[model samples]
Target: MYVTSNFTWHQLAQHVGGIQLQLEEKGFVKGDVLLAITPHSSFELILVYLACIEQGVICALVPELTTLDLDKRIQTSGAKAVFLCPNTSLTLDGALEIDFALEQGLETQNYSEQNLTSLIFTSGSTGEPKLSPTACITI
Candidate 1:
């Protein structure tokens, strides 16, 4: 579900719940990772996690983490794609901010268990950010 506010969690959940039931009726297995890049309070993050669980995919929550941190995590987990919010922006290697916009309608994609869900960078408590694998089951 797409959302622009933290208060939208309940509404998004209702929408996604319907979609999940529909998908189940179709006999399609849920994907393994619900990737999110929005702020922690955003409803999208919550819906993604719920959807992942309903579909049996792992939920990965990655936010405000540096690219270096992301790189380490991605390399370690082999995540297929990172789910990013359309209006959000992040700086890349050249200081350019990349923005991903969500489409206007419903969309679905297939994924495998081998796919990386999310890579979490360690907080440098050990002197460096370490990547950790995030999966649906881990949620």
Candidate 2:
């Protein structure tokens, strides 16, 4: 949860949690899809994933995707929103639902597993990737 160069884990979590609630306020509900196209290991990447989990949004972490490919992926995934990290250069010009890094926070919620928590993107070296949604049920 290294949000900033020096922020503590709790601090980063709090900030991301706020963003999650804000997204919820903006209509991110259970099983909605959110596209995150950052380096898979970056802090913003994980933060967004956690937030999506809190609000029941399915997060798709797809890296190295072309702009057109991303658009196709979003379409295929039925994503309700998109999150472009600070380091991401790809743009979704005509995307139906998209978001950049939020500088604000909102009310937060505890982690509750949703019906669909994440999506896996599959593509060969030659074409647009397809997304398959999956949910992990705790026993």
Candidate 3:
């Protein structure tokens, strides 16, 4: 169950579906990484993740930092696209952008699973930062 300041599960599912269609239509086939840079306070962040997963895309929900290291992470992620709020000035050439303005739900699906679905960067408060990728092991 997700509890946002003023959000519902239907809203989440609708947003997720729209994002899924947006990514797939942009040629985000299996095994592509989708970068998401947004504050944790944003409820749409969760929708972005769920959509990417449905499309078999790797969702790299990086932390919000104003450092060159962010560039390095985006580069390392090899993201085919990035999703965030519309008003933000975030830009990445050759990567598809999905904005909040297009949050209306769309029905689409092409699910695929890889050994890795996400790559996390920890809070530097603990340390500089670490790349801890979660690998899915199928037995």
What lDDT does each candidate get? 0.49, 0.70, 0.66
lDDT per residue (tens digit) for residues 9-94 in model 3: 78667778877877777888767887777666455676677777777777787756565866777777776766654334565455
lDDT (Cα, tens digit) per residue for candidate 1, span 35-115: 455555555455455555555554556675677766665554444445564334754332212121321223444444454
Residue 4, candidate 2: C-alpha displacement in angstroms: 5.2
Mind giving the per-residue lDDT tens digits that candidate 2 earns over 1-139? 3443676777766767766867777888877888877755676677777778777788888775776777687798888777776666666564323243454555555456536778888876866676667775741
Q: How many clashing residue pairs, candidate 3?
A: 0
Q: TM-score for every candidate vs. truth?
A: 0.50, 0.73, 0.67
lDDT agreement of model 3 with the native: 0.66
Q: What ranges in model 1 sit over 4 Å off?
A: 1-14, 17-31, 91-124, 127-139
The true-versus-predicted C-alpha distance at residue 27 of model 1, in Å, is 13
Cα-based RMSD of candidate 1: 7.6
Residue pairs with backbone atoms closer than 3 Å in model 2 (clashes): none
Q: Who is ahead in lDDT, 1 or 3? A: 3
List residue ranges in candidate 2 displaced over 4 A: 1-9, 94-110, 124-128
Model 1 scores worst on lDDT over the 10 consecutive residues at: 96-105
